[model samples]
Target: MQSLNEILLQKKIKEIRFKAIASIVCGFLSIIPYLGVLFALASWILFFIVLYDLKIYGGTKNLFKNLFIVAGIGFFGILINVSVLFVILKPRIDIFGGLYFNEDNAFLAIGTFCVLFYITLALIFPFFKAFYYEIARVTKQKYFINAFWAYFIGICTLPLFGLGAIGVLIGYILKLVAWIKFKEFDEQEIVNLEERLAKEQKKVFDLKWIKITMASFIILNLLVLVFIIFQYFISFVGLDYNAELYIRRTLFYIATILALLSVFLFCKKLKTYKLFIYFLIWQGLSVFCDYILFTPPSIIMSKTAYGSLIIVLNLCCIILAFLFFKSLVQITKEKLFYLVFIFFTCNGFVAICYTSLLITLNHLVFEKLFLVGIILFQVAYFISFLIFWLKLKGQKSVKIC
Candidate 1:
C-alpha cells in the first residue's frame, strides 16, 4: 500500500504527462485549418484544469493566479475578435444588409469596432507575458524570462502574422518543457537539475563555432539593412523604376542566399540543434517561393497556388522561430540572448511585409506607408542588434568542468 503523499505524487505526474502530450498535439493541430480553433479551445480548457489541479495539489498559488489572469485577458481578446467579425460580417449578410442605419449611427458603430480591435491587439503581449511567466515558474528555469520577452515582442509587433504564430509556437514548446520538469520534480529526480543545467550552459557557451555563427548572423542582417536602405533611398531620389526594381530583386536574392548559407554553417557545427534545422528548411522553402514569384507567369504556378504556398510557408516560419527561440532559451541562460533573437524575428517579418507590399500594392499611399514603416522598423532593429552585438563581443566563454 502506497502512502497518501506517494499516491498524490503519482497522480500529479500523470497529469503533467497528459498536459505535455496535449500541448504537443495542440501545436500540430494549430497548423490545420478550421479544426485548429477547436483544438486551441480544448487546450485552453485543459490548461485551466491543470492550473486548478496544481493549486490544489500543493503547487504554487502564483501559478494559478497568473494563469487565471492570462485566461481572462485571452477571453476578452476572443470576445473582441468575435464582436469585430460580427460587425464586419453583418453588413454582408442578406438579413442585415436590408437593415438601414443613419450616417451618425454607422460612424459610431465603425468607431466602436475599430476601438475594440485595437484594444484586443494591444492585449496580445500581456497575455503572452502572463502565460510564459507562469510556465517559467513551473519549470523552475530562470531563462524562461528570455522566452517571455521574446514572445511578448514577437506577438505585439504582428499579432496576425508570422511573428505572432512564432510566439504561440514557442509558448507551446515551453509548456511541454514545464510539464517535463514538473514530472521530474514529482519524481524527486530534480535534485541535480540545477547542476546539470549549469554544465549544459557552460558547454554551449564555450562553443567557438556558435560565437562565429552568431557573428555571421549579425553581419548578414547588417548587410540586408544596408541594401534595404539603399534600395529605398534611390527610389526617393526619383531614380528610374527599372533601376529600383533591379536593385530590389538583387537585394532579395542576395539576402536569401546568405541567410540560407548561414543556417547551413550553423547546422554543420551544431547538429544537435534540431530547431535550427527546422528553421533552415523554412528559409529554404521561402527562398523557393521567392524564386517562383519572380519567375515568368507562364512558367510559374497559378495565383491561388502561389498564395496558398506563401501562407503555408509563413506558418512554417512561425513554427521554426518558436522552436528556435525555445532552444535558445534552453541552451543559453542569458536573457539578452532572447531579446536579440526577438529583434531578429521582428526584422525578418518587417522585411517580408515590405517585400510583399512592394510587389502586390501599387497604390501611392500604401507605397509611402511601406516606406515609412520599413524605415522605422529598420531603425529599431539596428539599435537592438547593435546593443546585442556589443554585449556578445564583451561576453567571455564560461569554463566547463
Candidate 2:
C-alpha cells in the first residue's frame, strides 16, 4: 500500500492541476459583460497563486515576487483599460476636463478616438509584454510569447477594424491555450523532496484555525464596507440628516465590532496571526502619536506647514515601523512585503490626504473621505490577504520544512 505521504502528495499534485484549469475558467469568465472586471481580477489573482503553488512542483524561486513588476505596473493598466472599455461603450461620454467625442462630429471624432485609443494601447503593450515575458521566463513556457505577440499584433491592427478584431480573438485563444498547458511538472523532483514537503504541508495544516478566523473577519469587514458605501445613495429628503447619519454610523460601528469578534477565538501560539494585529496596532499608535505630539493647531500656520508636518510624521512612523518589523518580529519577506505595500503605504496616503483637506466643524466631507479611504484599503488588502490563507489552507499536516 502507498504511504500516507505518497497519497497526500498525489492529492497535492492533482490540486495543482485543478487550480491551473480553474484559473483558465476564471480567465474565460472575465469576458462576461458587467461582471468582467470582477472575473478578470479573480483571474489575475488566481494565476499569481497558481504560480506560487507550482513552486513545489517546479522549484522556481521567487515566483510570485518576480511578478511584482507585473502587479505593480499592471494595476495602472487595469484602470486605463477599464477607462478604454468605458469609452468604447460610451464614446460620447464626458471624460476628463469636460472632454468627450460625439457622433455629431462622427468623422473627426472617429479619427481622433482611433488615434487616442491606439496611443492608449501603445502604453498598455509594455505591461502586456512584461506580464507574458516574465511568466515565460519563469515557467519556461515559450508559447506565452506567442500570445503576447498575438495581442501586440491585434492592437497594432486595431485601426484596421475587422482584421484587427480577428487578431484579438486569436490572441485570446492562444492565451487560454498557454494557460491550459501547465499540466506537466517535475514529478521526480517532488518525490525527492517528499519528506520536507510533508513537513511544509503540516505547517500549513496547523494554520487552519487562523485561516478560518481570518476568512470570517474579512467577509464581515467587506460586508460592513459595502453597507457603508450604499448609504451614500440614500435619499435623505424630508428626513433628519443628523438622524440618518447617526443611524448609518451606528450600523457601521456595530458591523465593525462584530467583524473583530468573529476572529477572537484565534490561536495565540501561531505568531502568524499576530502579524496583522501588530500592523494594526502600529497604525493606531502612529496615528494617535503623530496627530497629537507633532501637529498642534498653533504650529499649523500655513498649508505648506501642515503638509510638511504630516509627511515627516508619516515617514518617521514608517521608518520606526520598519525597525520594529526587522527586530521585534520574525516574518517572511512576502508577508512583510504585503504589510509595507498594502497597509503602510495606504495609511501614509490617507494621512497625507487628511492633512491636505480643509476640515471644519461642519465640513463632514473630510471625515467621510477618510472613512471611504479606510474601507477601500481594507478591501484591497483583504483580497490578497484571503488568497494568502487559501494558499496555505491547501497545506496538509508536520514540522517546518
Candidate 3:
C-alpha cells in the first residue's frame, strides 16, 4: 500500500498546480485591454490563493512574506487608481463644465502618483527578488533565478517603452514553466505535523455564502411572485409590457452570480476546480438563453417557434441543474444532498412557472394560486439550509468562522 505521506504530498502538489494555473490565467487576463482593471483586481485574489497554497506546501508561516505585502500594495493601487478616475476626474470636470482638469490639477495628480509609484516599485522589486529566491530554494527550481532577473530588468527598462515588454513577457513565460516544474514534497516537511494534516483535510465549509445565496433566492423569488400577481390586477403605466420580464431578468443575473458563488464554495471543498469552470460556462449559456427568451428577436421567427425554443431551453436547464445537484450527491456521499437538490429543483420550477404564467397573462386567480405555490416552496429553502447547518455542527473538525 502507498504511504500516508505520499498520498498527502501528492494531494498538496495537485492543489498547488491547479491554483498556479488559475493564477497564471488571472495574471494574463489582467493585461487584457478593457477588462484589465477588473481582472487585475481578480488576479490579486488568485495571487493570495496561490501564495496561500504555496505557504501550506512549504509548511512555513512566514514563507513569501514580502510578496504578500506587494500583493496588498498592488491591490490598493488598483483601488486608488479607480477612485482617482471616478471621484477626482469626472465629477469635478462636470462641475467645472469640463475644465477642472486644466494642466495644474493634472500635473499634481500625475506627480503625486509618480512619487508613490517609484517608492512602491523600489520595495516591490526586492520583494519579488526574495520571493523568487525562496521558491527556487523550496522547490529546487533554478529557473526562478532567471525569472527574477528577467522581471527585474523588465521593470527597470519600462522607461524605454516596448523594450521592457519583451523582458516582462519572457519573465512571465518562465514563471509559468517554473510552476509546472514544481515538485511534490514529503508531508513530514510540514514540521512533522502529519496528524494535523489529516484533520486539516476534514474540509472547511463557508456557511456565509450559502446563507446569502439562499436569502437572495427566497427574497427575489417572493418579490417576483408578488409582482406577477400585482401586475395582473394593476397594470403598470408607461410600461408597454409585463414588468415581470425585467425583474425576472434581474433575478437571473443575481441568481447567476449567487449560484456561481455557492457552487464555488462546493468546488472549493470538493477540490473540483475544473467542474466549477464547466458550471460557469453552463451558467453563462443559460443566461444567454434568458436574453433570447425575454427580448424580442432581431431576426424573423414565428411566436410558435420562439415559444417552442423556450420550452426546449428551460427543459434543458432543469436537466443540467438536476445533473449538477446529482453530482454533488455522488461526490459528497451525503444523503442530505437530496434536500438541497429538492430546493434547487423547486426553485427552477418556480422560475418556469413565474415566467410562463406572466408571459401568458394568466387569470388573477391563477396568479394567486401560483403565488401560494411559491410561498410553500420557500419552506424547502429553509429546510435545506437547516440541514446544512446541523450537518456542520455535527462535525467536530469544522471551524464555523
Best candidate (score: TM-score): 3
Q: Backbone clashes per model, in order?
A: 0, 2, 0
Weakest 10 consecutive residues, lDDT, candidate 2? Answer: 262-271
Between prediction 1 and prediction 3, the one with superior TM-score is: 3
Instruction: Report residue 358 deviation for candidate 1 (angstroms).
Output: 8.9
Tens digit of per-residue lDDT, candidate 3, span 281-397: 557557656567656643636655665566666667667756765675666567676776677567667757665655465344466566567556656655575455335422234
Q: How far off is residue 97 in model 2, in Å? A: 16
> Worst 10-residue stretch by lDDT in candidate 1?
392-401
Candidate 1 Cα misplacement greater than 4 A, ranges: 1-213, 232-271, 296-299, 340-364, 378-401
For model 2, how does the per-residue alpha-carbon lDDT over 281-366 read when each residue is reduced to its tens digit?
Answer: 44444434434433445664665565566666677666655654553224433453345345756866786667566432325555
Error of 3 at 184 (Å): 4.5
Model 1 Cα RMSD, Å?
Answer: 19.9
TM-score for candidate 2: 0.40
Model 3 spans > 4 angstroms off: 1-15, 22-50, 63-68, 78-112, 148-168, 184-262, 265-282, 286-313, 330-394, 397-401
Clash-forming residue pairs, model 3: none
Assess candidate 1 and give its lDDT. Answer: 0.55
